[model samples]
Target: AQSVTQPDARVTVSEGASLQLRCKYSSSVTPYLFWYVQYPRQGLQLLLKYYSGDPVVQGVNGFEAEFSKSNSSFHLRKASVHWSDSAVYFCAGQNTGGADRLTFGKGTQLIIQP
Candidate 1:
């Protein structure tokens, strides 16, 4: 079984500033990972996913994540954040060891400071 963790429960950034939400995994095997965001009163929306090849993967809304097998990390980044980008971001992973159930991180709440 594999698990993910977001070290910061909340992150604050100025409007139009760059942002990065970190996600670290605890497993010898690199699990397939995905980043999701949840807006107020809305279900989670998939931002990006990584399985193989291409260490960097692009996501919606000017977001991207780089996968590092050595560090066991998949940190999500955005060049600039908008007010609407305020949301709870989650990192999830699925172990390739047969069980397809997804393990999710605690989530980080992104606050856009005006």
Candidate 2:
């Protein structure tokens, strides 16, 4: 079985500050790592994904993540976040085959302080 752990359940950041969200995963084989962001009452949007090749992957909205095989971790980072960036962030993993469903962490709620 595959699973993911998000250390922090919530994070608060003032506007214009950098943000880093941690994610740890456990899988039998190389997992397809992904970061998704969700606005209130909205579906999740793909932030970034690390399938293979490069260890680092970039996503929309100035977000990026680095995949560490040894540590089994994929962390999301944003250089500067705006008020609009305040949303729920989720760390997800999928098996190599598409048959398996995506496993997501509880999620990290981001609160932006004006």
By summed lDDT, which 10 consecutive residues of candidate 2 come out lowest?
94-103
Candidate 2 lDDT, tens digit per residue, 1-114? 437888899999988899999999987434698999999999999999888999989999899999998999999999988999989999998855667778898999999898
Tell me the tens digit of each residue's lDDT in model 1 across 1-114.
Answer: 437989999999999999999999988334689999999999999999999999999999899999998899999999999999999999998865766778889999999999
For model 2, name the residue pairs that clash: none
Lowest lDDT 10-mer window, candidate 1?
94-103
Query: Which residue ranges in model 2 land beyond 4 Å of their true spot?
Result: 96-98
lDDT of 1 at 77: 99
How many clashes in candidate 1?
Answer: 0
For model 1, what is the alpha-carbon lDDT of residue 38? 97
* lDDT measured at residue 78 in model 1 versus the true structure, 0 to 100: 98
